[model samples]
Target: MPTPNPAALEFLLTRRSRPWRTLCLPAPDRDALHPLLTAAARTPDHGKLEPWRFIVLERPALDAMAQMVADRGGVTGVEPEKLSKSQAEYATSPLAVVVVAAPKPSEKIPQMEQHYSAGAVCLALLNAALAAGWGANWLSGWPSRDPEITAWLGLSETESIAGIIHIGTESAIPPDRPRPDLGKLTTWFTP
Candidate 1:
């Protein structure tokens, strides 16, 4: 029989992302965040090729980034609503972690696998934050994908943002959203 961790399983089953807009102040400090990052770093890494990194964005940086997005919005022709949403995400966020998918060169491992590892890191970080009683949400928008913004983030030519995870205190508990239908989404295969 397989030994199971009931608490962990329960947490996984019930985990829900707190909306970014609903997140407030009292964000985790560097010391507090150290463990969360450590937990994230423990994500499965094939071949020990660590293909990701974290970039913590505190309030000041987020505010500046928000302004940068606004400044570039008009010139870049970003739609008004989209621009506003993106700006608000940064401006109001207490803290954020940018999971940069920096894939290291590997002879056996494929580049796509490295990208997947980065994505896994993002989820692990998000979950770690939530498990630590902090409200967390994984987000990405036009700003994340914009070359200029990515450049501002100091990403290299090959690096990309797997996710931008917002972490802070929750103003209010968000209602649980509908989950996907497991029967429809899953497939049972047999030879």
Candidate 2:
């Protein structure tokens, strides 16, 4: 017989990401965020590579990133509308954690698996924040993917942004979006 934690199961079933735009002030301070980061660090890593790191961005850093997006957008020929949206993503958020996928060289484990591990960390952080009573959203836009922007953020040549998780107080409860139908997506195999 297996023991089941009903509360944990319920939380998994009902978890929903709040929109970054809907998040307000009173974001978790460093002391409060420590546990969430610790929880995120517990993500499964194949071969014990630990190929990921986190960068917490406060208002000033975010503002600088916002300016960088605005300035670099013109050089990169990004459309105005897309540039504005990306800029707002950095400018408005009270606090965000950038999950960087820094893959380590491994003869046994592939780079793709390392990347997946970093992405898992992002989800873990997001879920942890939500479970801790904070509104959270995972975001990655053109700025996060752009080499120039990433370099400014101190990403090495081997590192890339897995996600930027924005965390803050919930201003509104967003209507739940449609979820995937497991029956249509799942396939049971029998021999």
Candidate 3:
């Protein structure tokens, strides 16, 4: 018989993402992040296609990204008023992981499957953070889609940034927002 983990299940049911703005310092160190990466690797991938890769944004990389974002923001037509605020997100975050979707073309595996795998990895990483007692959020900023920015992050031609998972201590607990009504959304198949 498979061992059931009720605690994990219950936690998943009640879990909430700590708002990115409310996340602060005390992020995971290299030794501490291994398990989280391992958990994220367990995400569902059709055809065994490992369609995602992670760019662990340590201090230096984060700083570079922050500056690059600010510069790129200027070129991308981001309003002058919001540019600094946008760059500050990277500079201030304790830790950030860029989930890149590298969709290798395959005759057997469809592109959609690769995209799905990438998305699953993001959720898995988020869950790992929550389970690890850290506040986390999955985000994809404007810089994610920029070719020049992606090149700096070492993405192949086919790869794109799927999400930027930020993990840190919670500065404030956000109120529970309303959720979509599942009863009204789901279709009954009993008939």
Q: lDDT of each model, Cα atoms only?
A: 0.94, 0.95, 0.90
- Listed in order, each prediction's TM-score against the native is 0.98, 0.98, 0.93
The better-scoring model by lDDT among 2 and 3 is 2
Stretches of model 3 off by over 4 angstroms after superposition: 1-4
Candidate 2 regions exceeding 4 Å error are none
Winner on lDDT (1 vs 3): 1
Residue lDDT tens for model 3, 30-69: 9889999999999998888799999999889999999999
Error of 3 at 83 (Å): 2.7
lDDT of 2 by residue, 41-112 (tens): 999998988999999999999899899999999899999999998888889998999999999999999999
Arrange candidates by lDDT, descending. 2, 1, 3
Model 1 alpha-carbon drift over 4 Å, by segment:
none
Backbone clash count for every predicted candidate, in the order shown = 0, 0, 0
What is the total number of backbone clashes in candidate 1? 0
**Each candidate: RMSD:** 0.8, 0.8, 1.7
Model 1 TM-score? Answer: 0.98
Score candidate 3 by lDDT.
0.90
* Clashing residue pairs found in predicted model 3: none
